[model samples]
Target: MILVTLLSFFISLSYETIIFCSFSITITIFSLSFISKYPSTYLVDYTCCKPPNTLRSPSHSFLKHSRLNLSSNLESVDFQMKVLARSGLGEETYLPPAICELPPTPSYEASRKEAELVIFSSLDSLFNKTGLNPLDVDILVVNCSVFSPAPSLTSMILRKYNMRENVKSFNLSGMGCSAGLISVNLAHDLLKTHANSNAIIVTTEIITLFYYTGKDRSMLLPNCLFRMGGASVFLSNKKSFRKQSKYLLLHVVRTHIGSCDEAYNCIHEREDSEGKIGISLSKKLTSIAGQALTANIHAFALQILPTTELLFFLKTLIVKKVFKQKNTKPYIPDFKRAFEHFCLHAGGRGVINEMQKELGLSWEDMEPSRMTLHRFGNTSSSSLWYELSYLEAKGRMKKGDRVWQIALGSGFKCNSAVWKCNMDIKTSSDGPWFDCIDRYPIHVS
Candidate 1:
């Protein structure tokens, strides 16, 4: 009787073990299936503007014109010109003819003309390269920080391309330079809801209308840094395009510190004591940007960093927080291990230098950004794309490589976008950097 009872107990244990194994297998299959069906977005192609010949104005010429046009004191004009010379922007950077003329007053008509030229040229080239009709685009996103007309930039694109009547359109204004990636994040969310959709994002800033001609030294910074540029990017979630796409959208992380008064006012548009309206970049902008970037990178690393990196970061956090180790510096993750290419925003030379030091990036990692700034100046939201194009031009981009694009904007916003290369990209003739790429990776100081 004892032997029979022991045998029955062993059989019951064997039956329970088989059931647990079957359940585990079922869950594993379901998880795999869910991952396989997860939605993905692709960047099929992109184009950055090579500003028209009529718009090109060398730095010395621009400074001389500004000195003559502004009624400010001679000392102020000379100081501003000196700032421009040391701003690390090369002579090739283009500006709208209206701004280069340094009109006593900003011209709305000239600003509109600049927009039409930049937007039309960029969109035309993008459509021609993608071979995808504009009408086929289901969503349109246009971002211009300082320029938002009554008809809206998105509406202008619609009319120019004669897109579908039911197409969804969005215009992001006053979001500052980081709005480009903001638009991309918005499009990614929209694509998830609507399958088999195509979205085009146009990023540009109109420096002509926003040109500050006043004597305010802070206001004059934009004049020195901004130049004519625009970029058009095509994104699609259609599985069919995956094979031909250039990059796969991996993640977009954004952090805005506008709630802090100092941050909100770090870069602001206001009328000065003379009632001259202009964007005033605060003296504390670099510090505010660094803080914003710290917050953004911390949040972003949580999502994409490797397990070992995260573990080390957590250990450091524990030592600082739990052990009350006040002297410990926060661990900076080695982003180089994760990203093969870096597109730090070409906001200015100072901005790039601060970022390089903070992130511990080598000069080679910053080459595209420095070159883009030297070649194109600060193109606002479009600068990131120009940097990416530089990497493609040099044949540095390869399949499976990961690219990181980071931008800081006036809202005291820091934003990051990560992309995995989908295929080997060849330098295309339509790219803004294609012709002069061989000359780039040049010394810029």
Candidate 2:
């Protein structure tokens, strides 16, 4: 009986060995077939065989260390990335009691005081919400459309934060509201090179400094439209740091239209003899924006989505073509399929209304933009984030969700950025915007 049992065990072992050998041969053959079908590129680090965070074959300790060093090196590459920070500097220096009242006769000092208040007030709103420490920021970029402060806004931020001497900085003025996204586009490029770097961007329009208190309704629009606003956004390319970040940079599209006088006339600032500064909105703005959006959309379509999806979109366009439909609106690309949240620019009642009419978005979908206009009164470039904050405040943002922000400004430009949410948005009851979020969808005059 013992001899019979041993023979059976040996037979079973032989069968198992044969099966293992066959499986190994099949895998080797399949691997060869795959390698032959694909071209090799040195640019790819072929070692990342699995999706992010998936367990894989162990690497040699030395190889792991080398990869870490390489990633660290990438972070130092000289590139531009827009960041939002150092608003506190502007807040501390400006505002009530310091310069209690406006001067009866206009003076540059009054403008300076108002500008200072604008910068600081906007900064205070941003930093208080973000809870970011001043010293931790590695780069600074600032944009003030009309006023360029002495010592440069960028330098002031560096001094206020006591940032490292080696930290990079940039200040942009007269670029208009679209300048904010341009700054962001630059920042994204910088981060692609410097993986560990963090950049801060502060965006505000001190229209009070350029206030047009003239009799012309065109000049008076600034007083009714422009209000105080500032926003700070932190950007990092380090894979480890992005796990909880609000949005991932997708694509940025810019178009320069109507150059020379005709172009500049679309959205330009001019002052009367009394030194009352104001922004003029031409009747042609809507048309210029339409053309620019068409161009921008085509450019954006080429980058983020797959060729098949693009083909499908084109086919839909062909099938649903409209020749002279009255009250025609821009095609609202299936953003539901593309993004989970929408932070459309809160330029004004007309701007918001036009976008909603064009995109066919419901009032619920436009909660953020509408609420911002009501509370903040069109904060210009920084208005987008305030809208985003509203969504976060309402506890509506979820992980793996997406956000789309579209801004319209000078040059008749319409710029947008897409963000993919990395985690559930957490709201603090302490926010200034918290109580008011519940009362949105209000009528705007």
Candidate 3:
């Protein structure tokens, strides 16, 4: 009888244990199912506007125009022009009509015209490509660092599209070129909360108004660097649109070094001694950018890098910190292993060169950025899209490939976005590079 009772007790305990295990498994499966049902944000399509032919300003034309406008010594102007030509910008980049003309004073009307032309053209193309009615857009984000007018950019977009009455809209000003990715992150968060929502993000900078006629060499740099361009992107978290999406956002990392005094004032907008207003880029910009990028990448690696690469990086950190190895350099995990394509910002030749050296990137890895700079100059926040478009125009993007977009800007900020190609992207006839794709990868001195 005692043996029988013990056997019965064991059987009851085993049965209860089996019931609990089954319940846990069911809960796990249900949780996973619920998680899978949540919507995922996707990039439906993007378009970069090509400035009109009237706006095209080759290097020689720009140099001649600058000499005619500025009161600086001919020698100084010539030196600045030479620096600009060697700044990795090609001969074909376009500037606003006002800039090409080098008006005696900055023209607000000309600035407005340039902004309207680029923004409208880009949005028109985007809407046409995606067949997305503007009325369906639930959120609108517009970023232009230097040009925020009385009728805000977002308000202008809303009026142009005649969007729905309650559409959420925002205009980000003084955020610098990195504001493009910041807009993307904003849209992502909004989509998560709104569910099945669509957002439009427009990035551009108005060069006409920001153009400096002043002789301050530092202020005059913008006169040489910035050109006319803009980009518009459509994002959606609707599951029904997944089949038509081009890419899925994997991660976004942003780092700002504004707390540091030097970084905060590195790229500043102020009036020169002559009371001529312009943005001054400090000589230490490249170093500040490198530091910001390093911090941003360290954060990014933790999220996207493979375990083996992470382990190696951790080992290097341990060796440097614990062992006090003075000569050892911190390991830059093989980012090439994590990403198949790279779209480093076409900020300038020096910026791109610095990034290449720091990341140990191959020439092929830097081609898109180099080509974009050569073709478009620095379009500010829109520059990254132009680089991405170059990759597509060259037929380099493949389904499932990963692409990384990095941008650095004023406020000493570094922003990065990682995307996985969800579908094969074909070159569009109306793309920014469509006419000049064949001539690209051209040697630029």
CA lDDT of every candidate = 0.85, 0.57, 0.85
- Across residues 187-303, which tens digit of lDDT does each residue of candidate 3 receive? 988988998899999999887887777678888787777888999999999988788898998788999889999899989999999898899988888888888898787788767
lDDT of 2 by residue, 329-440 (tens): 3345664556677887776666676677666678877878877766665677877877777777788878777787777778666787877676776775644465556775
- The candidate, 1 or 2, that scores higher on TM-score is 1
- The residue ranges of model 3 lying beyond 4 angstroms of the native Cα positions read 1-38, 102-105, 321-324
TM-score of 1: 0.91
- What TM-score against the true fold does each predicted structure earn? 0.91, 0.69, 0.90
Mind giving the per-residue lDDT tens digits that candidate 1 earns over 191-286? 989989999999999888788767888998888898899999999999899899999998899999999999999899999998988999988888
Per-model C-alpha RMSD: 8.7, 21.2, 9.4
Compare candidates 2 and 3 on lDDT and give the better one: 3
Best by lDDT: 1
How many clashing residue pairs appear in each of the predictions shown? 0, 13, 0
Segments in model 1 whose C-alpha atoms lie over 4 Å from true places: 1-38, 102-105
Which residue runs does candidate 2 get wrong by more than 4 Å?
A: 1-107, 110-133, 260-263, 273-276, 304-309, 316-332
